[model samples]
Target chain A: MVLYLIGLGLADEQDITLKGLRAVQSCSKVYLESYTSILLVDDFKARMEALYGQPVTLAHRETVELEADEILRGAHEGNVAFLVVGDPLSATTHSDLILRARHYQAPGAEAPTPVPVKIIHNASITTALGSSGLAGYNFGQTVSIPFWTDDWRPDSWLARIGENMGLGLHTLCLSDIKVREQSIEDMSRGVLRYQPPRYMLLPQLISQLLAAAREHQVDFLDPERTLAVALCRMGAEESATRRGELVRAGTLAEMLACTEPDEAQRRQDEQDDEAFEEANPTVSEKEMDARREARRVQRAIDFWGEPLHSLV
Target chain B: MVLYLIGLGLADEQDITLKGLRAVQSCSKVYLESYTSILLVDDFKARMEALYGQPVTLAHRETVELEADEILRGAHEGNVAFLVVGDPLSATTHSDLILRARHYQAPGAEAPTPVPVKIIHNASITTALGSSGLAGYNFGQTVSIPFWTDDWRPDSWLARIGENMGLGLHTLCLSDIKVREQSIEDMSRGVLRYQPPRYMLLPQLISQLLAAAREHQVDFLDPERTLAVALCRMGAEESATRRGELVRAGTLAEMLACTEPDEAQRRQDEQDDEAFEEANPTVSEKEMDARREARRVQRAIDFWGEPLHSLV
Candidate 1:
């Protein structure tokens, strides 16, 4: 049995290569490794279904980190493909998995430990960010900002960004996302409190950065002098937006106003669109008609003030 | 008049996006920026013809750095596009041009002053190297090697790589490329010592790396244990190879054995085969030709034998 690892790149479903598409088609079971990063567009499932005529099982962070053996259990019988957003091995977790696979190869194991593993490469955000005209080599340590807490807001990221700027290097700040997890309230009460997933928007990120900078006394980075880029709807069909420029309150406010609610709605609309597109045409007509009612909300979000978030 | 800055990714013609292609199509004059990097598969003329149905004017280092006004002159009359290998702004030199355009605007010139420059982004090798299971954040300072040198061959890149390893980070070593320039002999004696543009193979790079390590007295990295990935023909339609493994002389030798002379020729043959299939009336082509040609020369160089290079 062959273990095929494929990189789905940063953008929409089509960002995958012809080679990767073929591997997914022939695989007995395909698992989408749903951590490290999320694809801006949610039509990935529909696109994969359209191209390969197969349902893809999503392997979230828990499944990959904990239940990896279960994910690879049936690989000995036929082809098993694991799809990862961006390049397969960009994240340390995936690399650890590859090492585990190597260790699991036994003399008489059904899957014969030496399973042929092939990686199909695609575009990663690290390289894609170069569009801002920043030299790739001049980039310093990258940091992520988790959803802030009133008592536990960390300002360590400011130090890192300061260090990078000191060396004349640019800092790539990745926003955090909370997905498929219980709320803080639920965890404190020992009860299951399932909350909706949230993608951090540019406004919140900027505000946090500002707050952190102020608290850390990072006087060098003023909003007007320091250049920052916010990318929204990256690698999507309607992928429109901003480039690197000096950070301004007006720009951040504008980005927030457009992205805050619309992002969630866009995700829902994309999911419904994929489902509608995948269903039998005759039966899905009514559903498609019903889905059209949500287009107004989508349009409202699309026409919002500044296109700051769309900047690559 | 607008300055349309387009990124031609890493490899061949098809790597350019539909928007970039359109920008190139509408522009009367297009210049390919050549100093920053070299494309593996497509030349300026060939890519321009294939993507935009026009011939591209090649702007070498001197042409761009010295004769910038000539390239910008057309922007005042009509749309002008500067085609860069990666993203338009990835290099500081292009950004400097943009700043110059802003200066022109400040003078209140009647000309367009290249305002409202459009940037088209594409994948770069910086993040492409992350496919080796190396974390983007884990990479330290990146350095490049030049082709020609005097008696003193600089080995500072070795120190940088060692520092990265000390921090448990991977090093991205950009190999040297010498393209489209008259040699020293040509300038001094008026005899063109035009050598074929050379791309450092993986074996050569590894050899140098080993020698540098010995000189620096660093034994932290074991060629067999150190993970190295060699990527060749990135962002191209034809065979793009990404091989990851421990480095050794035998491995490097094997990789070199597979390198091909002409990638364009192979792609042309494949296209021809596809055209033949479409035109043929009788025979049913059941087999999908998915055989990826081997261009493993870079890999061979990466894994050169123990005591890789003798320090002269």
Candidate 2:
């Protein structure tokens, strides 16, 4: 019996390695960590179930963070699979799980019984960003930009980027993703309401970047001349790479204007959505809301399609 | 027609994604880029042939750098697969091939016919180093340590590492690899002779780091106290991670002494090699030489059991 932590490489279900697939098939229980990143393909859970010939339980933050002992218990009894988007250890939280498994002990047993753990590595954004044709050797530390709230805004990550820029090294910036998050008000009030998932779009990311540059008065990024590459839906069938300079406010829209869907196209997409709802009436409301949010983002950003967007 | 640059993820044949495998199976001709990195599995070609049901041609540095036109020609007429050990674009040379395919023109034709290039990403050393339990976000720019030679010993890469350390960030140091290399004297004499391939081991890497630190008079690295993690054969079944402090001269031997093979084990390995040679008398001289070199490397590196070794 072993605890197998497998990485589902970026893209869709098909991106899983044969080694990972075999491990999934042989497991008595399989868990998919779903909140960190989402696959580009639709019906991901259904498709994975069909392929693995077993039902997969989606492990949300609460499940993974609070109920890990149950997962280890399953592994202690029989082989269990924990699937993560990208490399299993890419996230620091998952590394904590590895440490937990090492020190796990059966609840009833007097002695400690650590469950054996194994990792099946797969492609992660840290490396898949190489599609930008940038030399990995020259990339400085990776930075992540979180979404700004009313009272909480941090610019330390920007300083990290500046440090890398000082050495003429490229920095990999990971955009923010808000999944199953509760609003501050809702949390404060002790309500059970949840907000719709939000994936950071390029326009918002660029806007924040420009705003940060102005506020921090950093020379690392030239508002009119700094070059950036926006990689969207990387490793997917319709993946796109766009290279652009960070220009003024007007230039931002102008650069993306050519690729923006026109009024007629937007109307057609809305009509198609209506037709889809009529055709598949059984679809859950949550799924419909997510799809509509994705469509709204598509109209806002010009060229990108699908999700799991990143920048370099 | 598409020129598919498929990534064979770290470890063995089964590490390739289902999508990559499908693309390889559909290709008209397949070429394995062999000089940049080598797969750990034995008879990699045979295993891939068995999985893909097709012959795979070995594309050495000469064939890929000089004879790329032929490969692009195959893709121009039909689908072709170019296999890379890690992520295809991880190496700059492969990125050059992508550019060539994009601008490729058909010979003896009136107009240019650029072939479509598609990349199937996979796990690379950049991200697979996550197995060390280090956060990818804290890693600074990657640096490569080249094997020093008489008259030209560059330590600029050391400076890059020092910069990373100054920022309280981790640095990924890629070890040097020499394949199908010809000595300067041999090249000057117009000789076709080549030197045996060499891969940088841990001792040599640490020795170079310490020597450069002393020569440059840098305070970034403390020879007696700087902590370092050595990641070897990452993503493989027997992948290992070792953490230790960078101690003085004699301590290096003391740290590695525990993992070193004993005299009896060395004798057993030599006897096993002799028995293998007797069993497979028809094996090529080049194959035997490569095996012997790999064995020598194993004895030099205490814990690493494969050729592709990296450090963080």
For every model in order, the fraction of real contacts preserved is: 0.39, 0.83
Best by lDDT: 2
Cα error, residue B156 of model 1, in Å, equals 6.5
CA error at residue B153 for candidate 2, angstroms: 2.0
Q: Write one digit per residue (lDDT tens) for candidate 2, span A1-312.
A: 899999999878999999999999999999999888877776889999999999999999999999999999999999999999888888878987888998998989888899988888888887777777788888888888888865888778888888988988887778888889999889999998879988787666666777888899987676456777777767766424522222122233343453466899888978988898999999888888889766756665545543555667
Cα lDDT for residue A270, candidate 1: 78
Write down the RMSD of all candidates, one decimal each.
15.7, 8.8
Q: Place model 2 in a CAPRI quality band.
A: medium
For each model, chain A TM-score? 0.73, 0.82
TM-score of each: 0.63, 0.84
Q: State the TM-score for model 2.
A: 0.84
Which of the numbered candidates is closest to the native, going by highest DockQ? 2
Model 1 chain A weakest lDDT span, ten residues long: A303-312
Query: What class would a CAPRI assessor give candidate 1's docking?
Result: incorrect
